[model samples]
Target: MGMIDQLLVIWGEPAAGNRQVIGHLARSAGEFRFWYEDDLAKAQARGFQMLPEFPVHRRADDPYIGRYLFALFAERIPAPTRRDSAEMMTAWGVDHPDDQFKVLARSGGIRATDRLELAEYRAVDDDLSRPLEFRIAGRRHITDAAPLAVEDAVSLRREPDNTADPAAVIVDRMGRKAGYVPRQYTQLLGGLVERGVPLQGKVVRELLLPDDVGKLVVRIVSSRL
Candidate 1:
């Protein structure tokens, strides 16, 4: 509801199968803390591996803490010294491109070389008056789709049967399946839906990239807010 303080380190791609929540990276008491989720063993069985920089022995009870962002995530953000860094900063709505946490949250920390991605984690009890923006996930799997334009209205449908994520919220454009909402927001938005809160979504922007890997950003608003 205020400033985002945590992000879910997601592993794997939903389209490929067995997408899992690896862990959580949070800002606590003026320092950064990171820990693997309790069910890491289950994820490991499904092809998930502990990051080389973060060994599995480090449990949730005793997490890794540091004054700055962990190298595992810090490397994902583009360097502020890059020639196009300013352009990238503007694209991600980051006022200070060097602020690694903000950059990571806004950019999704996605890379083609790996299946790992970061998703802003929001508490279900947090205020919803402020509109939340997230990039539609699984867009690479959407086929035979018309291009989405900015300001286009979208629809959200709960997918209780979804194996990857039971709380998954499917984003639809004109009755066609576009993609699912990022995993991080599912619990919060899903909880709102369960309480019969009216939620609306609209396309705020779209980025058409190479290899048909287009991304769409949708802004969600709740009537209760």
Candidate 2:
């Protein structure tokens, strides 16, 4: 089975004249490539997502592409201090916001749209599979399919009696328990879910079973990779 490979980002402009960094994925994965479908004229408090690992560049390309790559992924770490270098790397998350981004990519053609907007958490919890009283609250491996293929939507179930964990439990759209949010992630991811930030999940690969689908590795991708 393939591991999850996608990331979400809160779409925000670094500052004036530094907008080029928007939608500019520094690196690429296998066959997929990501580029901003349009330009951002202003800061969008809204969150955005992309496959950071998708392969979009070639062996040879514009010098500018190579120049800005470091800024995009490293979040401007080791920022060049030179007066000239700093001016050039302005759009490369030069300010260096604490937020992180992850790359969730698929092997074949990318099914995600350019926007990659994360759906609201519990968006599908009340759908057809949902029961009136919500019986399967703490269940696991209950769905035959992944939450979302291209862009994913996962429901966060807080596990209280979760002898294993208490931070958070990842459930599929159908409310099947998928996995736990790593302890490190619970602070951010768990808080997001609690605050209603749509935690999107991407199913890069899965294990198929005769009677049912099994072991769906849905990677929760986000700006905080």
Candidate 3:
């Protein structure tokens, strides 16, 4: 299993610049789950563990917009050859081949055109007062996916649910009205599913957020390492 180190969410509109931050993740047995609801009893009952919630900054005077969430998985990569370093101080063979081994690591942010292996959907519940459950499934092997504009992702409002007679899913990307899907990413997700890739969660647009925040929803189905 791969390790999920950090999850970052960037929110806000392009005109407003983006309000962004890196999120701290709570540890699960081998995977991590993030939800927008206030509670997590059912997920716990399903054998999924909760990592800690990322703290939110609340302002008394301002109304709250939604947040963008990013998940980072840290898979161990083999150390590069010591000679690969542009700077070399000590030579190999003396105490430990170059007294110290130092290398810079970079975070993998989604590019405009990167392939994401994922399944996305809006969270649904039996009652209005009940919590919404968003289901995400990651792909085993995904590539050439790109982040879609706010208007491009698709909306999944209602679907048959075995748990409830009239359960429904509603997602509002940009928080316009109740919820609607952006068209572009939705098509991409559908293609992956048709190809038989394993998915993690449904990738939906974050609504009520500023339209300027450029971010992509990606799923990790196969091991990249």
Candidate 4:
């Protein structure tokens, strides 16, 4: 199976509910590499701490290289031995559950145990003509908005004045504020919007259970066709 080359490591403060890119992980020719970003210091000041496997004292310029995936991320992948492992992998669009890089990219390496997550870093020129899925962020804060249902059409609006992130792209449902696009796709989607590229969004999934309320996944496609 094919694999992604790079992923952005994002750290979020659970209390404040803010996220920032703190590092990058990459794979090239069988070797894996990881390095902290300059933003690491800012994240540290915001109550983020060095991961046990990645020391804060390490110089950002010197990347850690290894033949195997870092434990920090490897642990996020569901164990192949789990009874529902195949279902989980299929949900993430991964055919091979053992393809760690692809799984991480599709799943965002999200785990309840940590605030760290991974996002595939797509190039500015990457094609968006194909449909892609992105979980709407900040839904929990949109209490006044009406519930969204599958197949519901959504609109994207740029929020250049947003205090937290100038590149923010908000999703709207039935003319009400639903949520914002995940930060990982903001740069890409925001750039496209700036270029006057028409984009379309439709609700692909919605979790309505008490615990997973407001969790939504939207399918986005460039309307350049």
Q: What do the candidate models score in CA lDDT, each in turn?
A: 0.77, 0.35, 0.27, 0.78
The predictions' CA RMSDs to the true structure, in order, are 2.8, 18.5, 19.4, 3.0
Off by over 4 Å in 2: 1-153, 206-225
Q: Please write out the lDDT profile of model 2 over residues 1-225, one tens digit for every residue.
A: 222222222242223211112343333443222344343333334333333553332222331243223333443232356555444333221233222221211111112223222111122222212111111122242344334442345565566675555665555566655455433234555565666654445543442222323433344533232
lDDT for model 2, please. Answer: 0.35
Per-residue error for 50 in candidate 2, Å, reads: 36
| Top lDDT model | 4
Error of 1 at 206 (Å): 3.2
Tens-digit per-residue lDDT, 108-210, candidate 3:
2222332111212211211112111122111111132333342343333332342431332333233332222222133333344344544333343331112
Q: lDDT score, residue 202, model 1?
A: 92
- Kindly state the number of residue pairs that clash in model 3: 45
The per-residue C-alpha lDDT of model 3 at residue 20 equals 24
**What TM-score, computed on C-alpha atoms, does each candidate reach?**
0.84, 0.28, 0.19, 0.85
By lDDT, the candidates rank as 4, 1, 2, 3
Over 65-160, each residue of candidate 4 has an lDDT whose tens digit, in order, gives: 899999999888889899988877766667777678778877777766788878776766766766667778887776786678878999788889
Give residue 210's error in model 4 in angstroms. 13
Candidate 1 has an lDDT of 0.77
